[model samples]
Target: MSKKGKIISLNDFKENRKLTDPDGNPFTGVCVDYYDYEDEQKEYETRYKDGKENGLCTRWYENGQKEYETRYKDGKENGLCT
Candidate 1:
């Protein structure tokens, strides 16, 4: 789906663990976060639904190695997280 609203910085979203549009609606999409050091690999990518994690969450190391992957349902960890 299209990005819901004004783009929010990764840090800001992390602090609250919730994302909202300018109108205060829950955000739904892949939230991609990157390392401070410039790199082609992203730090993480998480799928969100209604402002909470609802699908796969994947992370990587700065060297571009995949760190781990976790699944979530309604913001709570579920299924395999490896």
Candidate 2:
């Protein structure tokens, strides 16, 4: 999969500090998190729009299986999540 934007730690995403890209702009695009400290396995792939969750968000198992998927709009769930 192609990463669309910045790759930040889950802690940084949760801390929500400024939430800007490397150039000090509002973050837009995908923010990926890993299951391991070394970034070996993907934990989640969430799409963002102006710093809000605004698209299909997916979680994965450490074994590379998808756990669930949820759609969001303006940071809120917009439809059936599965």
Candidate 3:
């Protein structure tokens, strides 16, 4: 399968052509958040490719307060911080 924009599972995101860092490692960031749903892991993690954030990710409290904001590049975080 091409596996592009397929919306695979979290494991898939971590195992597939996962974003890497400057050292060719996995690019990563943590967005801490909260939610009322049963799912406790409400935060979003910023992803990256070659040390750049290039994907959709955000952090908001379960009550709906934006905890943090970020940018991405080709599926990685590369610009700004909030």
RMSD (Å) of each candidate, 1 decimal? 4.0, 4.2, 8.7
lDDT of 3 by residue, 1-82 (tens): 0123222222236534454433444545432233543565465555444434466567776566678877766654567878
lDDT of 2 by residue, 1-82 (tens): 2255344432255635324565556667887777884766889988888767889999999988999999988778899989
Candidate 1 — which residues are off by over 4 angstroms?
1-5, 9-16, 36-39
Candidate 2 residue runs with Cα over 4 Å from true position: 1-18, 37-39
Worst lDDT window (10 residues) for model 1? Answer: 1-10
lDDT comparing candidate 3 with the true structure? 0.49
Best by TM-score: 1
> Which residue pairs clash within candidate 2?
none
Poorest 10 consecutive residues by lDDT, candidate 3: 1-10
What local lDDT score does residue 41 receive in model 2, on the 0 to 100 scale? 88
Leading candidate by lDDT: 1
Q: Predict model 2's lDDT versus the native.
A: 0.72
**Deviation from native of the Cα of residue 36 in model 2, angstroms:** 3.0
> Which wins on lDDT, candidate 2 or candidate 3?
2
Candidate 1 is scored at a TM of 0.75
Order the candidate numbers by lDDT, best to worst: 1, 2, 3
Error of 1 at 28 (Å): 0.7
